[model samples]
Target: MNTTRKLLVLASMTSLVTGCTSLPPDAGFDEVSVNVEQRIANKVHWYTGGEEDAQVRQSIHDRLAQPLTADSAVQIALLNNYNLQAAYADLGISQADLVQAGLLKNPVLEMTRLKPRNGEDASLDIELRFEFLDILLIPLRKKVATQQFAAAKQRVTATVLDHAALVRKAFYEAQTSQHMEDMFREVTSSTEAALEAARRLRKIGNITAGTFDRFQLSHDETRLSLAQSEMSNRASREKLNQLMGLWGEQTQWLIEGGLKPIPFKPIDVNDIEKRAIANSLDLAILKHDIEALAERSGIENVKSIIDDLEAGYAWDRESSGEWSDGPTIELRIPIFDFGHARRARVAAELKQLQDSYYARAIEIRSSARALSDRLQSSRAMVEHYIDNILPLNRRIKDNELLNYNAMQIDVFKLLRAHEKQVASRQLFVQALRDYWLARADLETLLSGRANTVSDMRGPAISMGGGNEGGH
Candidate 1:
């Protein structure tokens, strides 16, 4: 075949190869959305500023019209959060790289014209050059880019999952804070009434000044605590709003649920470490890195001596219309850079990735075990309050009421028991919050999405005598 015909044939083959990987309209978000939906029942959308943007906005608006639940809150964030939408850009960028890798460089065309001094004769030369070596390397290049793109998808998917977990955590925190504020408000009211009664007693010289002062101080402190609870609730609610990408009227939305008790049940976590390592996207990404590097190392080793190669066709035509055509070849001789450094770098990276993957596996296993323990401890703490501490406080309050009715105890003792009972309930609320947080973290980890360690030690509920804790 003539050089021109051969080049045309090669071009035809290249075009045929590039058609295999055309991306869908949403890039790769369908897979991510499906994965998230399967795992958590959360729906995700990539807002394209098209008709779907209005749909998602309407969806979020509808969900926000009522009181928010944790799952709905996460779904809204996945659809509406600007940050999550921004994160979807990585998929687009990576998919572009993958598509680019599967194609050959464009052919370079050059034209040259010459005229004699007599101006009677002219020479025309035309040449076309392309990186013919690229055709051979396209598969390897695509292989590497494919793995890297897969890694990018995994990482971005992990980001979405982690975001969902944070939304859940923030939702529970806001819920607990809301309930805490209400409880403190009630406590303050009780304290105020008791202080007023004590004031009447002091006026009648029935109680000492010290006793009246204590009652007055308790009421003042309780009011101050109510103020603190209000601010805390505000802050937690605002954080949840930020995660859900809400502003304006959406910020005024209410969380529906209180700190409902999570059932205390035995969860088999003995295999959780193995499952975590298996599911962890972090390790999966490293595996892709290792695969791409290994493939790259083999390619570089095979082509170490050939730094650059190009071949094409050249044609020359004299002014008499006589034409000549031939194949042209160009090669770059490797004198100083034999790709030794490049090969060594790839090799080193491959080794580093291997070792790092091993280390990360260990870390994931440890984190899984730690999170499992935290989940169990949180569950135990919640159950302890429900089964022991709160019940005991209620019983003590009952005994105090009986003693007061029988004239065996003073009002001060009865009030003290009542305060302790309220503190236990407040503490129980925080314990439930911690239990939910730990559950979110563990589930995210086991699903191979997130690797974060939550604040297993829950927020303290402070009252007069002691602060409540879940640890």
Candidate 2:
């Protein structure tokens, strides 16, 4: 073809493809929503401060209007948490990459003029060059990018589900601490009043100084326990605040409800092992990565042997008014490198991902079983505190009160019974908290993500059960 015709065709190609932009409207965000739909139905918002973003802000405000339950907390986090919004940027970047992958490299043009030795009309040359290989590889590049985009969406979904679980954990922690604080306050008040009675009894010679001192000690310990509970309540409140992305006045939000009672029915774990493995987001991401690597390996295999194979149109005008125009070709011969090193690198990475996938599956199965055991064990602890310990303490408290009223026992003995009952209640609060925490962790592992192995143990706090015979 003539130089002018070739130039016109290349220009036309660039324009046509320019209008063929491949960006998705919301860039696979809806797909991410679908991925996490099972875990949360809350709509996520990327806060870019437009009209839609304004609507999202209003939605968040409405959800945060009341005291937060677990669902509302997750909803607000999905819409308003800055980190979750930041996570959406991965989708944006990957979509941009996909768009870039489908596009051809911009055609390159070169022009020059040179006078011959005889000072003839300056010889003119013009060439338009582009990678034909890029045209052949567009589909492969898109395949690779599509897989990477899939991995990105899975990762974001995993992040969303994990954050929801974490918020649930934080909510329970906050509620448990609040309950603990209230219970300890009552214990402190009862102990303080009993101490006052003990002073009177000792002054009247109804009790020894040692007995009065013991009551004083009990009151002091109750005060200490109350203080510790107050600290825990404040700490847990701050953690929930952080997770919910609240600050300033927003930090004053309250939890709506308390933890539920432990159920006697155990959770069914018959297929949980296989289910966790199947639903694992980490495993899904690895599969995408491996597929992406496979596509990349195909590209590298070609590129390693022939890194650059560019073809173009060349035009020249000589001094004698004669013009020459023809096609031009370019290739980079691989003299030192035979693609062995690149093939080895791709093979190693593919194998690494394969091994990681298997390892993750095994780890997930074991964690599922361990967390299942932890959940049942937590229920048992709560039941034990209620059935074996608290009821017995309540009976002891009733008998001691009757004896004291009949003047058959000292006030100190009656105070000891009251302390034991309060101690049982304290243990019950701890067991209840641990039970809920355990359940949250187990549920998260089953659905949130695959890489995590949560610690089954609860935090070591003051067990504050007065077993001092009197305490």
Alpha-carbon local distance difference test for all models: 0.79, 0.78
TM-score between model 2 and native: 0.90
Model 2 misses residue 341 by how many Å? 0.2
RMSD of 1: 10.3
Q: Write the per-residue lDDT of candidate 1 for residues 243-357, one digit (tens) a residue.
A: 9998988898878968766864666687898888877778877887777777777668656777678887788988876888888999988888888887887777777778878
Segments of candidate 1 deviating more than 4 angstroms: 1-22, 49-55, 117-120, 207-211, 318-322, 453-471
Model 2 clash pairs?
A: 466-471
Worst ten in a row by lDDT for model 1: 461-470
lDDT value, candidate 1, whole model: 0.79
Q: Where in model 2 is the C-alpha error above 4 Å?
A: 13-19, 50-55, 116-119, 202-211, 451-471
